[model samples]
Target: MINDDLTHTPSTDQTTPAVATPDDRRPLGSTGLLASPVTVGTSGLGTPASADGSPAAGSTAFATAALRGPNLLVDTSNAYSDGRSETAIGDAIRQGGLPEGRGVVTKADQDPSTAVFDRDRVLRSFEESLERLGVERIPVFHLHDPYSVSFEDASAPGGAIEGMLALKEQGLVDAIGIAAGAISVMLPYVRTGVFDVLLTHNRFTLVDRSATGLLEEARSRGMGVFNAAPFGGGLLAGRRGRDGKPATYAYQAGSPELLAWVDRADELATRHGIPLAAAALAFSTRSELVDSTVVGMNRPERLEQVEALRTTLIPDDFWSDLEALGTPPSTITD
Candidate 1:
């Protein structure tokens, strides 16, 4: 919910049919992962349905959009809002009458400090997520927080990775993936090629380019890559929008370099006559390294930010201008 737009509402009625094919059906990227170029993040879509607690307008807007065309990939986690996000997505799926074409991606969290791997923990976590989503099987299931755990343990005989693979084999999941805290954490798995997708941050994002190698690895292995946090937690989008504040409220005090980057981003937007969010979205999708850019929506109006994609696209020069204003890859000064 932190990065979501806040003016949307949720629906409680299940009578409405929420399935409609959009005119646009495109592959996510060269990676062969088919989906709408614009994927919806369900992080905060499940909050209170309405001010009266009937249904949230935000949820209805997303459901409507999903019904329109955008592959509608909803990402959630067992740990997000103590599992309310998933529960809310489930409620919205039922009440809004979402269709089967929309895919759900949910993560599994485990304590890294525990050297011992537990299959029961993995099963329980996935089962709870399925229950919250009110789905028989999640289209995509990921091994969340794949940090600190050894690859052997991660893919061991009875580890979480193995459990997920079992689920995939049993048809409980269409595909299995690894969502790490960083791209480096996903490298070993990428080499294994056992996973179909890799969801991680900081590799192709605003502040980092360290994961370029990982992207190539995934491509070589014929796996899909999703760039998370392309905005660098809103640092890349710069400040100010129709909302009148920075995209992220979580950052109260930022570095001097960060502020300067924000200023330059705004300048580039002004010069190119494009929105900062569009620039960021265009940047992420332009890269062969990224299959999809995950954008979170909490309000109905927030969808307007991305709705531009339906009609407008940023020019290549917008990216060139942004790169000129951002930190150099070789320089870690920021």
Candidate 2:
């Protein structure tokens, strides 16, 4: 069942700080859409339960807070909670009006169960997203998780990418993008120059820089890059005092090496007297290649913490010490 709180109109009291205005907004590649450096990721806002059937609370207040900001970008997908994320955003927009010039980025992908990747599915998925978002046109529509199915199937003639481009030509989507977990699968499309934006998550962060090459390639092709999960999933985002919960990397159990890497990062945070999450968030956004860093939030308090982390300045020596710990094999140039 969908959470009733997410279905109802949100109160105005739930608003957060407004997004940056036009003059202050940062360019999002060649799309001409100006957005804040930090995008609000809504994946956690609509998932009803964990794989263990543990209750996961979804909040309209979080959506309201995200939309209250000016020039902010809200990232969602039809796959998230079977489209509940988009519904929550629509309800929030109706209850709490969206800030001027705010951008909404949603995605269409094949059904995990069916593995269907075709033009009809893509168009139908996008139509559902538009209805759920309560918008006639979307600023950015992404082809989500192409690697789950055959990338060739999704990109071939009469495929998902072709459908998305058709929508773009019709002015339904200002720009099309690709968001996926597999860098190998995404690189081919990135090199093809079909997408205006690219989003890679859990691959580029304080503990990992696996996507550095992909980020560079996308930037070289004039594509906007949005880096997600800067905290190495929930590992780097947890409070300092608590024993780290079982770490999950890229939505899977963290390997021993990954866990060890996070432990070292925790130790470094303790020494510097900085929140681990603050450093993680800053590291991802500090890179010139990243046009925006998306962070998922489930509560208004989490949003407040993110805002603080964005403005908090870390010393140069902190970065130097961080780099000394160990850099990923791939070189990350500014």
Candidate 3:
């Protein structure tokens, strides 16, 4: 369902012998960057310690391990944790050292205080990201969540889009991407034929296939497609919070009907004797439409957990049954 050059690993699906693994490195669209099927998201990366201005040792250790991988991609944003996400990740990479072919992808976000996504703000954002990330150049830089700025302003000459293109010209950014929600808003940007990547989150998961069209279009155009939040922010994995409460999708509550769908999927996984998270993960990795699946792994233990999930062999029938459940009614399906 993608370009001729974009190939996918064969799905295991009970009949296939190989279990789904993130070890396989594939080309990321035409960017010349080969990355792991799963990208480590730094949305949950903690801020630097106030006393010493250093990130937690755990985060650095995790980053070191991930960096050492053949070609894993690290996803971060300018606004995440008010810039500390980039700081922590950059610190980790600095301490661990960046390996060739391994990529770190960050986004240029609108000013949180001003809500300005104009050209000046966008350029400033990218500069800040570079400074925080402790890097001279970024492999991939995205315009993260441009909904605050109208389509006209974002696309106008010398606007946000131009700023990103300028970075590409200067060699500051190898590939420019558009990462946003709202299919309506994203589609128009997709037609511009300038972006080298597309990152969609919360909309392309086992429960919600809203980003299917976005993924398809990006793949067709030979642009890298990143499907984030495959676990719907831990709901599909049945993860609990530090408070021991059930995880919500995108940090909001889920509808009862949607919960029903999740319950059914969980039960089905139980019957199949496989982790529900595996099914959720496979939903992305098994698809040739997605070049990478971005998952938030705040701690080192997450590495082991993801490895286990990827190795779980799920049957095709389970996916069929889950699909039969259909999209749950009502929005905010957690």
The C-alpha stretches of model 2 lying farther than 4 A from their native spots are: 1-24, 49-58, 239-245, 328-334
Model 3: worst 10 consecutive residues (lDDT sum): 1-10
lDDT against the true structure, each candidate: 0.62, 0.73, 0.74
Count of backbone collisions in candidate 2: 4
Best-performing candidate as measured by TM-score: 3
What would the TM-score be for candidate 1 when compared with the true structure? Answer: 0.79
CA deviation > 4 Å runs, candidate 1: 1-20, 28-33, 45-69, 111-117, 240-253, 309-311, 326-334
Q: Write the per-residue lDDT of candidate 2 for residues 1-334, one digit (tens) a residue.
A: 1011112222334444455453346788878876677887877565574465422334555677677653278888887767777887887777766777786899987865787878888898998888888889899999888755676777789988899899999999998998986778888889878899999887788767778899999998888888887765566776222275554655556666766767787788778888777888889878898989888766665656677887777777788888787854222222
* Candidate 3 all-Cα RMSD: 7.7
Which digits, one per residue and each the tens of the lDDT, describe model 3 over residues 85-136? Answer: 6787687667656765677899988888989888889889988988887889
How does model 1 fare in lDDT? 0.62
